[model samples]
Target: MPLLSYSRSYSPTAADVGHVIRVECKATKRVGGGVLTKTVDTGLVLPFPPMPPRRQMLANVNEERLTPRLRQIGVFRVLTYNILAEIYATRQMYPYCPIWALSWSFRRELLKRELQSYNADIICLQEVQGDHYKSFFAPMMEEWGYEGWYLKKSRESMGLEGKVDGCALFYKRNRFILKERYPVDFNELANDFLKQVQTEYDLDYQGPSMAAREMFLSTLNKMRQRLQRDNVAQITVLEVVPANNEMVARKSQSGPLICVANVHIFSNPKFPDVKMWQTNMLAKQLERVTLNRNLPTILCGDFNSEPSSAVYEFMTRNHVPLDHPDIQHPPPQLANIYASLDLEHNIGFASAYASVFGAEPEYTNYTGAISRIGCDYRRSLTEALLLVIRSLDRCGGLRMVHTGDADSVRRAEGTPT
Candidate 1:
């Protein structure tokens, strides 16, 4: 017999938030001239509440003191979030959280409210499913004066038939103008690697290490297959525009042009080499995009590699030994804004939370019990993600307003930060 199916609804009382509503369905089957009956139980929580009023709550009373210092230079906020794709929330992945509690219907509003609270100028998002992008995020963000750009992984490369998760970039329409956008796919590097290998090898002359040569070729083929499914990066060059008329009068001759590269790198911990390869490709691509080299760049995303990984070291340091065969070129020196604070001590932190708060990194991604339902559960998730946002805000890495005199503003004719 087919498995029994069940559904649930929430009670509208504030007190009903945490209470579980159990749904039972009865199924009957005939076996060996006997009737058998079974009951299936499904539990659902009343998690949704009216959308809270959007507000920005300052974390520190002393934050007001820093406002003048921030005004000395123009600043803008960039927020990166991996809004876990709704379709991928399978029961197997989140065993502790009930499937009903984890449904997109239950989580979307909470996620949207939390994201809107940041009020960041440049927002980078990962794992945004295609349908949700078209039906939800795009139209909704447009209402808030933000333009959204998205690129999904090709289904053929990923071997998935339907919509695949991809990276998204959203910019506040008023604060910045989008100049150029380059969508990078790391898979192209694999083809380049193949060409390099072919040119370096002497196929006509059989060498003494024929067996070793075949083994190397086999590994190359495997790598090529792996690269085809690698995550993509959306590199956008934006010109920071003056937000108000007062700033326009003081605008400087050299308006700031910032290159914001948002990427979700490869995730598998076992494939450190692949991560390095992806990072290297990203660095090369960035160099090509920003030919001037002086444009301040902000690279943000869910780079699956940790702070201790080679990928992290390469991005932050001025130089590193590029001994790996797959790494064809040395990575350009890119500053990790979190680590830039400890330049004198040379003690780099693993995350923004550690760098700013001086505390061990806390869990950014949670898959656990829903201790309290409704707003409490929503607050828990929002607060955890906001910790990073808070750190960035406190450290002066992000600011909502366009501060500083016009002379400090960098302006380019017909250009866009």
Candidate 2:
């Protein structure tokens, strides 16, 4: 029998979706008035949604109504990628890029093809630099039926002031509603930043302010802020909001909000200090958001450290002693993301695959060969895939979409860290 199916053919209206899904599940459990779970064949139904798909990624949904069905439904799938942008596709006969980001043409098409083959709804990417977004990614996303909204690291931000480089997030337009937009910079505004730099870094001038020593120091401090920002999760929420600003206009409950963060922390050998600061920053951000309520938040990306470090321990809820040394800042108000023992099955924790092969993963964010495999190869998501997903269940805010394995993918797909 068909194990999982959408409600359209089974239900006549949107309100009837849950009822339809439950009925279709053939639920077998006798808990409460229903079964908590069901079983299906591995080679069972593979239903592909119609093109111009209405819901390619389920970022915005009425989760309260759909939770029961989801538990009984098929596993949600997610893909965590650090697409080696600057690296050429042919470079390693694997995932590491063969050409530079600026000149990578046909090779990138191969990467896109692989992405489609995976058929994942939600994807998390790290070390994705500026060129990928401007060239290959922007157009390719359009072609693949995805709507893209990217926010650069605020510390590195240059909007209206000037430009700096960092990260981006993409989701299928049909599946996500762009509900809110907020940009956080180390400084309130860029001009204030200029003066702050002038005072702090020392006001030494030269050709243009851009060429002045003080200007360079100002840039350095801003990057330091970005480094700290990395400590905290850079969460972007694409929750349901009335498209015409109707909800706020009416002052009412609009819909559910799901938060998706794109994480990329520093790694070993590089500036470990930078990683710790930024990671702490991410933890602090999560604390601010989850303190008052159980808002669903999925923090995904590359953390160079393993499950044993203070950062990992903090995320997983193994609380440090009250007088722990590293916690110079206040204890974060948020619950550790990986603390929920129940969801341990989802957190894909392990030594990163990139680090295992005596090298690192290829990444697109850098201009050099090592980064093309993945900026911090030892921190590639593939290594901790299970731990990453399992940690989502903490606070009942995030859930794993995929339980699949990257090992199944050929070694040539990308460089192993």
Candidate 3:
């Protein structure tokens, strides 16, 4: 592939604030004896402040509640998204999607449609607000054959008078029945660790001076507060049921259980130690569940830590030393889907737009003056499959199972048997 770059600038008046402008580009390449030309059209729109409308029905009033059993046979799709909470959709974070476009009223339907398109059996979401969970996600998902569970950060921990954002998990009710739920609270764990420290070593007696003791106490208190306010994880075990009783009986001999852990780790880039601690804690929690039950585990979330961080290394590597004040036990070996599938090669660029355009994207996290848009700046589904195919490719019959996307099907077809 050849590299290409193009740039243009234009000035707009106040009247064009919310209007979308179309930009078109054409690329031509000579192949064999003919020329192949491709034209791409993109739209740039200014962010309009979101305006809240009247409260709408939580569920579809017209549609009857249908409870149909969906059979589970083989592997199912899973999706993880960090739907930016409405409360945090300020003008600073999203300069483009401001007051109008960023409102829950406008983004809710778009998020729903995008999520529906994925058709995933299990969905994990982060940063979902409390009211939105009751008024929107729970009811909407219930209507769509899913049972939803949400856990919000406590008011005291969050230092907020009202509700705050938290993680939410939704699963197809018919395909899988919830067996067990273990909610991990790092804050409580930190408190327990502090108590252990206090008991094991006398802080006052060992201290060289009163100032030193005060400093130690202050540091410990701060750490405790931070941990309490940190994001939490929910681990849910679901029993996968086959179509009929006969198939279920056969499968039940081994007791098929799927453990899905949904989490949202702390986002502060400055405090990498906190992220590492949280990741290790989560790993240990998962290990306890899986070790006891021998369940197939699927961990998903907006980890907030990048691929290169110690947190990522701890999760993916077979054995790594966790040197943290709060870490008591070694975390069990867990496989990172990306590394296990060898999809790291596909991530040559930082942003999704960069991958598509073969250059650095305008912005990865937010929309700015350029208004560049593509798939959410994350690795594409095609890239994710490349990772999945590493092990599945060995299975002859199941090599190309459910290759939905055109690019993925092409890639599968091109791969040697």
Best prediction by TM-score:
1
lDDT of 2 by residue, 1-417 (tens): 233455534313344332323433455556677655553322222232122212122232334544642333223345666554443234453334333322445436556766787665556665555656776677877788766555554444334332334445666554455564433342333334335545644534434455566546655455444334422224666543334554462356544555566665544434443444454445555545544454455566766554434555455542333233333332232112112111111122222222222222232122223222323424433333312322234223233222222332223343322
Ordered by TM-score, highest first, the candidates read 1, 3, 2
lDDT of 1 by residue, 1-417 (tens): 222234444333465455554444444455556555554433443655334333232222244545433443266667878777876677775665556656887677777766787778889988888778888889988998998699776544234333578888999877777888999877776677566655555564457387977765775566566556558889898876754663563355334566777787776555655676676677777767664554556677766654445665666552334443323322221111112111111111133444344532333332332333222213222222221221123444432211122221112110010
C-alpha displacement of 64 in model 3, angstroms?
43
lDDT of 3 by residue, 265-322 (tens): 7776656656766766677777777766555566767666544456555554433344
> Alpha-carbon error at 333 in model 2, in Å?
28
Off by over 4 Å in 2: 1-76, 87-103, 153-165, 182-233, 240-253, 268-270, 318-417
Candidates' C-alpha lDDT: 0.56, 0.43, 0.55
Ranking by lDDT: 1, 3, 2
Which 10 successive residues of model 1 have the least lDDT summed? 408-417
Residue 76 error, candidate 1, Å:
1.7
What lDDT would candidate 3 get against the real structure? 0.55
lDDT measured at residue 138 in model 1 versus the true structure, 0 to 100: 93
The lowest-lDDT stretch of 10 consecutive residues in candidate 2 is 337-346
Model 2 earns a TM-score of 0.48
